[model samples]
Target chain A: MMTRTFLVALIGLSMGSFGWADNPNKPDDNTTPPSAETSVSPLPTITGGLVFNSTFTPGTQSYSPVVNPIVLVPLGNRFLFESEYNVNSDLTRDHGAWNPRQLNREIEYMQLDYMVNPHLTIVVGRVFTPFGIYIERYHPEWIRDLQVAPIIFGISHQQSMGAELRGAVHLNSKVDLTYTGFYAFNSTINYFTGDRGLGGRTSLFFPEKGVEAGFSYNRRLGDNRFNLYAFDGTWNMKSIPLDLRTEVFKTGMLGNGYWVEGAYRLNKHSHNSFLRKSQVVLRGEQYFTPSAADMAMTSMSGMMMGDNFLPDQNTTRGFAGWNYWVSDAVKLSFAFGRSFALGENQNIYSLGITYRFATGGSEK
Target chain B: MKSTLAIAFLTSLLMAVPAAAGNPSKTPHSHEIDGEAAYKANCTRCHIAIHTYSARSERTMISHMRVRANLTKDEADAIFQYMAGEQKPKAAPTHTAKGAAIP
Candidate 1:
């Protein structure tokens, strides 16, 4: 507790030096100096809100309490403050038709960010490890999609004593480049511990009119540490009301996988009105993973070796989903997903809702 | 009569130009997304914002999705392609001199 207090104080002191909370509205201090003009303009601001998630089972019904509350504060154009609190209860059993429960309270995310600039930012304290896209954004009540995260990337929700730095730069108005780098010193909120992994990514963009494309790579260390690479592209229709996005990714074990997603606006005139952005998404994927033993050993090696981690069998998937934006900040999604395996198949049905505060930027 | 017909044909072509220009698919452009929206909708569940911003890998991300979704190679490829295409390339990072660090 004392250590946590001291750390918070230290962060506050640093913010004060930059005149964040004390004089954020002061124009001169808030704006970047001409010599350091690469920063994202408009500086930073503080915002807060609350969100909750609940689940239901076949025979039993469950409701998660209003658990999560978040606060975000910006220091100058370089530092950001983030805190998340959760105190939800789990219902274990019932007595005489009454619900008996175990309630838990914890901090999910709390950290301080020091932006060296728009191209570089560092974070310390309890933080999240950049593992995979789904794991990084798995909260059902907070996500716009209905699917769950994959098991790779360790599947943990939080990490402590973590640090990371990431940013991007514009080569010109039509093209830009971005990168991310990170390290976690300890376990997550659930107390899982293991060796830390290193990750690097580079992406390019062409925002001239309508067509766009991007590519990226990532690597890590662990029992099953691995590498990944991908290429993606999108096109917006002119004469009709349609948009298209497609992507492909390859990994040591899964070989390569791909999907195409498109959303058409029911009403295009009002900039795809929040209520009229209702659309359908269709996706498909394929991969190969070696037998369990080979996977375990390859993961243990920590060396980047291709062809060694291929799965013994092949896995395939096909899914179609529906998504609607009730409002810009509130979204609803439903998906009927199916998986095909060794002469067998499985199916899943999912429903989800999400609400995001008005903080802006590409959190990707 | 011939001159009048040519003028009418040219006007028709001009009208088509705006229609073609308005198409996001036909044109090549960059998309500036609401970072918070992208994070909350897609990235906030398994990992939080700070973790994602730290630079996780495309392989790691795709592998996780494949395993979780039990996706086929084609399906996985499509998703990967879509995501990679959406990324905007950024400038290469430059660090300060080693001596700049505090002892």
Candidate 2:
């Protein structure tokens, strides 16, 4: 409790010191030397989201509260420093009593980026592995359309400590080519560990059509020598407020899987207020193991060897969910899913709420 | 089964082209680019809320998005203009850093 209070107080003090609560209409601070040519640099800002979830399964119930915070500091016109952290706790019902688990704190990424030009940026330090669109773009609790992760998520290396080159180039009037290439070093340091690997991702984005498709390739080096390949795509319909996304991945020996999801917001087509605030989402996925022996091998190797949270046999799952936007920053969500394994079928239910917040930005 | 899945995926990709092509109305004219349209096109995939930030912070945020979202320079600039309310007149040509007119 004292640690939580201290953390809250520290955040509050930081926000106050940065003038995050200042009125945007107020005049600039008058104490500075009023040199007309001296420009006002942007202040560092904090932005992120908090989520609370309650889930029920056949014989157990669990609750998770998570806070993900991101900080961005602009160094100059062309350089910026950014970092993100995830603090979460899980409480589960065991023997009819709630058992609280230890808090899990993780550093998502900490990196410095230099925008060299319109088409290239240099990034160094710890960064999310550029494998598929999910980990980098939709992993955040507040942003994901569904509450649960895809089946293929275990194959992705969550983060890497290394250097990366990323940028976008205009291919023509309506198309753009975006790419990222990186090399990560092996590390065992606490909170900053990563397998040595090299990988790259490339995509063609049709801005006019609101569609993007990409492929990623990663080659792991060392004792766990293997190659991982992934393909992902996203499309936002121009004719309606609908989104379609899909990902397919294959990791050598361990397993292969695919998931496709669709979400539709009713706002664009509805005049009723409640309907306008509502969204419906559906997702389907399948995972296949090479064999029972491979499954046994994977389970024995543990999470670091890509056996985290996966079933011991082939599985297929389908989910349907609804989300209501209480406000732009707050949301309420519910989902029901069913999964089929070798000889068993299970039902999963989840209810959650998420609140997103930002500070040290302009007070619009 | 794998072959069927691959074929279905390819068919969906193929279907998207026509569907996209049919919606010519959403495309901005060659002479003028709409900042709000560009913003909606590029930035609304993950979330829908648009937070206001100081000019400097706004630029930094958009730059960050440019990297994360893989937005082209023109799209980023257009979004910046729209968010900042600094959009040029419809008749005016928005020039890139190279002084080339954006299509």
Q: lDDT score, residue A4, model 2?
A: 38
- Report the number of backbone clashes for model 2: 2
Q: Write model 2 residue lDDT over A1-364, tens digit each, in one string.
A: 3223333433443333233222335443211122221244556777778999888888789898988888888887568898989888889996588786869898888999876544556688889888888876887777888878787777674788876667665555688667776667788898887877666677898877989999987766545556678999999887777889999988755688889999988776667777777889999999987555544544345334321366567899999999887766677899999999977788999999988776754344
Interface DockQ per candidate: 0.03, 0.14
Alpha-carbon runs more than 4 Å astray in model 2: A1-40, A292-308, B1-34, B86-103
Which number leads on lDDT?
Answer: 2
Off by over 4 Å in 1: A1-68, A84-109, A131-161, A186-194, A209-216, A223-249, A253-259, A269-277, A291-293, A298-314, A327-329, A356-364, B1-103
Question: Model 1, range A151-177, lDDT digits (tens) per residue?
Answer: 122222334445544433434445544
- Cα TM-score per model: 0.51, 0.79
- When only the first chain is scored, the TM-scores of the models are 0.61, 0.85
Residue A35 of candidate 2: its Cα lDDT? Answer: 25
TM-score of chain B of 1: 0.29
